[model samples]
Each structure stands twice: as structure tokens, then as C-alpha cells.
Target: MSARRILQLGNPLLRAVSTPSSDSGECERILTDLRDTLHEFQRTRGFGRGISAVQIGEPKRLLYLEFRGRPYTLVNPEWDWRSEETFRLWDDCFSFPDLLVYVERSCAVRVRYQDLCGASHVLEAENDLSELLQHEMDHLDGILTIDRAIDRNSFCTREEWLRQGHPATRPEAFASKT
Candidate 1:
């Protein structure tokens, strides 16, 4: 597997819901590509924690994440629960790296998913992890960070956002988990 091109904003395929993954081999291939692509983006752009297969034009229900030195591959994930209390933050995406959007997200979440080997596992995430899960999950359903923007004014260019000292929405930094 190799680094693949990330689907940018305005791609029609980014608007299409991804299909559930069934083939383990294909899932692994996509997972590897996702890992490579995410790392490359991180190396060059300096930030990115997770990526969905759909972002690489696969349109499969798969997500790859590297956080705190741990790597996770989630296949056909499902939401177990989400916290009622939420927080707002400026979110960004590989699909539209130049734009930042203010959005609200659950403070915590529990998810169930299978690994590349078909083993089932559950992940209980809070704060940063919660937002990362929510962000990648949105891609499987054809949703983008911009789509979650709180309002018409909830937008800013990367340079402007940086120049403005990266406006904070809460105690956390104004960065999308990915």
C-alpha cells in the first residue's frame, strides 16, 4: 500500500455514503493506504490523527487512526453511545485543510468495531479521542467538517485562522482531532 490522494472538498464522491466493508483483504489494503496517506499529510502539514477510507476514494466503512503512538483500525464501526453534554471547537479536515469550521461535538463516546483480523473490540473515548471518532465517522456517512459548521460565520482560511492566534472555542486548542 502507498499514500493515496485525499479527496478534496467539492468531489461528488465525498458526498456519497460509504458501504460496509466485508472483505478483510481489501480492508487491510485500504487501511495501509490510509495509514500512509495520514502520515504523509502529518509529516508535511504537521497535523492529522485519523482518516476514513472514503477520504481516499474507497467509499468503505473503514477508519485508520494514529494517536498517542497507538494505531487503530476500525472496520464497520458502530456507535455504542454518545454523551449528552457537548463542546464546541474549530475543526479542520484533510479534505479541506485550508479551511477551519466551528462545530459542536459530544464530549465522549463509546464505539464497537472489528479489527483487521475480524476480532471485535470496543473503544470508549473522551475529549480529544471522542472528537476524532466523530469526525472520521462522519466521513463514512458522507459528512464533512464544513457541513457541521455552526453557522455561516463559522469559517476561516488557514492563514487567517493562524494569524488570529487560532481562535479558541473552549479549553482545548482550536484543532480538529485529524
Candidate 2:
């Protein structure tokens, strides 16, 4: 498997809504590629939470996420529930290469998705995990954390992002799947 080239911020694919897989067969291939892509991202970037197929030029509703310690593979994922509390956090995107956007997201969430084995799994995540799921799922919806920022000018380059302090706020509500 090859390390798929991550689509940068200006790529139209990052702005377009992804289509769901045509069938389970297609989803299986997406899962494998996504897993490979995730491995590649981890190896090259040293960190990542999840990725959507669209971010790699595949306009399918597929995502692979690792929440803190638990790795989850989601196919045709969707948000089934969300929490009332919201928190703000600094978020970065692989597609954007290296830019930081402070955005608000749910503090807790409930999601439903299909695993590689074709079984369904319901996951509940909070804090960083919840933030991650919301972020990847936004890819499917043609949305990015950058869109949520009230001050777009606050966006920072990778170098500045690293030097910046930790996220100082959180969104009031959070829910996500995938």
C-alpha cells in the first residue's frame, strides 16, 4: 500500500461533500486504504486523530479515527447523538498541511458506524476523542474547523501554531460519529 498524498487546504475535494460508498465491497477497499493512509500519516507526521477518504481524493464517506488510545474504523459513519456541553479547542488538519484553528465542539458525543468486519458499533467519546470525531465527520459534510472560528485571521502557520499556547476555550456542545 502506498502512502496517499494528503490533499492540501485549497483542494476542492476538501470543500465538497463526500458520497457514501456504493456497497460493502467498496467500503472494504476504502477501509484498507484508509488504514494504510492513517499509518502513513502517523509515520510521517508523528501524530493524527483520524482521516476521511475525501481528504485523499476518494469522495467516499469513510473515516479512520484513533481516540486517545482506542482506534476506530468507521464506514458510512454518522452522528446519532450529541451532548449539551460545548468546548473550544485548537484543531489542525492534515489536508491543510499545518494550520491551527481554534473551534468549538461538543464535550461529549454518541456515534454509530460500521467496522471493517461489517458489524455495527456505537461509540461514545468525550474531550479530545469527541473533538476528533467531530473534526473528521466535518470532512464528510464539506466543513472544516476553520469554518467554525469566529476570527478567521487567528489562523496560524504550523510554526506559529507550535509556539502558540494550548487551546484556551471549548465549544458548548459536541457530538460526532466516524
Candidate 3:
């Protein structure tokens, strides 16, 4: 239940695709670590909603998230459907906490995944949760938010992003075809 060290952006482990976890015991341990690490990040860094096992150097297809007070554990999650519509937003990650990448994501998504007990479930998410899940799922596939940046100017340091008064407020700056 200890908070594990989250691998940083340049770590090769972060670039490797995570393998699916078949053991319930192993999945439980990873889930606990992800939850603990997510909470630790929020406590010290002020914000974090989700984390992937790869972010902790486990290279397992597991992610844990806490959104709007509810906790979620996604094992071997895969996209079942995505909306044709998309939206632009400033995306951040636990692997690169100091950077903000402006990216586009599906406005809605449906994902099928397994629980810790090996029970399958479907999660349909929209808006913020949709983006958050997409972001974490990308980690399972060795993709980072920076790789999904809308353009070269899509990157900003945390300080610069805050100075700009939040990218959501300046929609014109992120204007690009979705």
C-alpha cells in the first residue's frame, strides 16, 4: 500500500507498452500502489486524478483513478467506442507533472475493462472523465500527452500555463481543427 515512485518522462520504462495482468493478487497490489501514488501526488503537487502501472515502472495494463470522489480500477482496458466529435483541452500527466500539453480527445468514449476480481465491466464516460481515461489508457500503450499535442505551440510549462490564466479561458490560442 506504499506510494511507489512514478517514473518520469525520459524513463524508457514509460515508453514501453504495458502487459496485461492476469493474476488477481498482482492486480490488487498494483491498484493499491496506484491509488496511494495518486493520492500522494495530489497531496504534495496539488493535483492528480489517475495513474498507470507503467508510470510506476511496472509495465502492466492497469490504471487507477479517482474522479469526483469515486474510485475506479481499470484492468486491461480497451476502447469499445469513441465519439466522432472531439474537444481540445490542456492535458497533463503524472509522468511529467511540470508540463502541460494542449491536446484533442474524443468528446465521449466507451471502454471495456476487467475488475480486480476478473469481472468484466463497461464504462461510458464523457467530457472530463472521457479525456482522463483516454490519457491514462495512452500510458498503457506507451503514448504520452506530448505526443498528442495539437501543434508545436501546444506545450507550456506549468507556470506559463497558470500565467495565461488557464488554457480553457483562452480558447482562441488552442484553436485548431478537431
lDDT score of residue 82 within candidate 3: 94
Candidate 1 lDDT, tens digit per residue, 111-145? 99999888899999999999999999999999999
Compared with the true structure, all predictions reach lDDT values of: 0.91, 0.79, 0.91
> On residues 112-157, what C-alpha lDDT tens digit does candidate 3 reach at each position?
9999889999999999999999999999999999999888778889
Task: Mark the regions of model 3 whose C-alpha exceeds 4 Å error after superposition.
Answer: 169-178
| Highest TM-score model number | 3
How displaced is residue 128 in candidate 3, in Å? 0.2
lDDT of 3: 0.91
What ranking of all candidate models by TM-score puts the best one first? 3, 1, 2
Give one digit per residue, the lDDT tens place, for model 2 in 74-166. Answer: 888889998989977678888876777767789999988877667788988888888888999999988987888746454667786566444
Mark the regions of model 1 whose C-alpha exceeds 4 Å error after superposition.
Answer: 170-178
Error of 1 at 151 (Å): 1.1
Distance from true position, residue 76, model 3, in Å? Answer: 1.0
